[model samples]
Target: MAISGPSPFLRYGVRIANEAHTSLDEAAETLGLLGYAVVDSGLDADQLEALRARFNAIHAANHASTDVERLRAIGEVDLLRCPLADDPLFLALASNPRILELCERLMGAGFILNQQNGIVNPAGAKTYSQSAYHRDLPYQHFVSTRPLAINALFCLDPFTLDNGATFVIPASHKQEAFPSDPVIAAQAKQIAAPAGSFLVLDCMVYHCGGTNRSAADRRAVNHVYTIAMMRQQIDLPAYLGDDFSTDPKIRQLLGFNHPTARSVEEFISQRKAK
Candidate 1:
């Protein structure tokens, strides 16, 4: 028996490339099947400039202090953890409605922001923590029927082959363990996206940041949104203080309503009150 395209005996269906679908539909579908998708953020020039400026300023401040040596010791460099605590713009970007829509589709209602960090692939750097391939929920070797978390990484600079675009293994989220080196070498794909675009991913996807071979740094802001039951990377509600936002959605997204109880009585009371 000759196989013309895919074998009819195969149990799985193959998606046709270049199908006619709306942008949101394409993003949702790709995120499910490929473990990642790229979507235009639609930020204007001024907005893009503002985000880039903020990231640069924060990056400089972090690098100027003892934090640089401390981070470098742990193989982490050029990272600004929880930049939203420093600027309102970062908070706004974290809660962008378009991003929330996709998060809602994958994570269902009431997903909370797990972490937001500013990432920089320094020009001509040999290695950094992010350069190593790992899952957003690192050290886990399990697959979920649905996504437990998703990363919405906003590009502040255009991602290119010369400037360290992200490398991802498509549909790797479905596997229980990291693929062998040969499989990774054969299947890893570099994602190129313009500034003011997002490279969204299933948190389980195996991916890494590429080394920047270009003359300039590549900057991005990464937001991880997870199901509300998961602990946040940072205690955002506590870190941001009680008065971060009056909007109910923003409050909930920041984990304000999901605080831990101090005692059994408090836990029962809190549940009853809810």
Candidate 2:
């Protein structure tokens, strides 16, 4: 069939899908129409100050970048073997409602938090450290089907033009990858939202966090929600474990069961983690 749509992934489901106009679901649906499967909001005013406090602690403790942690943990494998889900700061980041709503829209009825991490884009950080365009989901090991996934990065500091912000190729999720052109790379759009802005993105879309050249650090928290079928990078069971109720939403997210009756897929398999 000659499709008259942007792409299958871009297909925005039905309207009034989330109790009509008053819900965040409607906003998510609208974002889907643009081939972006996620939506993010400004940080809730109530938690902004607390977030700032936590950001400083994370920076001082040298836990801002995954690559850094991954390297250090590998060297001292015993000390860092624990899954990242148990981190209290991470838990706080995962509970953001704006993130919850968008994840639900893309991953279906019971999307749950899978990962929490941070990045402090300091001024004059190495260029490659910011990363080149890539898809978070395309490279992950998946089973018979692709589970839905969404990712959000909340800018703790204002992402301005001078300081680098994330750059995304709109509608690129359907492309699976981007074209190779020096000109396009130079002209690609940068998403520079102010502090407190949430730059949510579809997991499969091609994007890259930009380099920071400003006089200060540009911080953000990176969190991901995956459909129940997929193995979270950090096991849910190990993270929240027994501290909370086991509702289906919480259970599936805790890696107790697959939500929506889906299958499990992992890059590196382990019987106990899930």
Candidate 3:
């Protein structure tokens, strides 16, 4: 059987959650129990469907074939340019107000819009070693002792275990590092969200994109926001930095107003401070 207890990752936030209510309260509660929270929104189903179409079109053209290579031994690929943000249909998701406030509370007062990615998992892609059991922390250039990293997934289509939905090990963020021998497969009770429903995960949790055994492609928009220390997996500040502060949606993610100093060099400074 799998070992179980309060995940070391969620210890602090969960404490803060039990003390409050509302979305803020829920966030604290997630920290206490699950190590993350899904803030509800009215970004709506239509918006998500439209965004999906926009992504599928771009996804088709972005490649000569829909066949994209993935590290399937670990199960999935984190594709950075999915074109959802560029599509007008995705405007609401790119700029949701509730998510912005949550970013400020969890990441920091000067958080950064770390990365915006689109994930595509093909049918029958292998699982297990593909993603391996890991926390989202290993790749950080800058980080905090306190958890300040957050990733949100916009399920463009319904997410299910049979076809690859993102999976997590309850609250696993508290671990200093990821498990090398974590042999359990992703829980079947995965994040099966409706279209437009967004699920957020604390970067500390052990997670990976599950295998897609069905023919339909499993797609999602992954938007991650972080404290100043973490280097984004994408060229964030360069692409979105100038308009980040003034862009109301982006601003909420930043906890910061101006992001003129964003660069890899900035990441080094952040790493040093920690």
What TM-score fits each model?
0.91, 0.68, 0.71
Tens digit of lDDT per residue, candidate 1, span 144-238?
A: 99999999999999999988899999999999999999999899999999999999999999999998998898899999999999999989988
Q: Could you give me the TM-score of model 2 versus the true structure?
A: 0.68
After the best TM-score superposition of candidate 3, give how far the Cα of residue 33 lies from its true spot, in angstroms: 3.2
Clashing pairs for model 2 are: 158-195
Off by over 4 Å in 1: 1-21, 65-67
- Arrange candidates, best lDDT first: 1, 3, 2
lDDT of each: 0.89, 0.59, 0.62
Candidate 2, residues 121-218: lDDT per residue as tens digits?
66776554445677667574332223367777777777777777888776565554364587456656787777776677667666777777778877
Worst 10 residues of 3 by lDDT: 71-80
Separate clash counts for every candidate: 0, 1, 16
Every candidate's CA RMSD: 5.2, 8.5, 7.9
| Candidate that beats the other on lDDT, 1 or 3, i.e. the better one | 1
Q: Clashing residue pairs in candidate 1, if any?
A: none
Alpha-carbon runs more than 4 Å astray in model 2: 1-26, 35-46, 62-89, 138-147, 244-252, 257-274
Candidate closest to the true structure, highest lDDT: 1
- Tell me the lDDT of candidate 3: 0.62
Task: Please write out the lDDT profile of model 3 over residues 92-210, one tens digit for every residue.
Answer: 56556677677677655777667666777766777533245455665543434466777777777777868877777775665554434443444323666666667777877767777
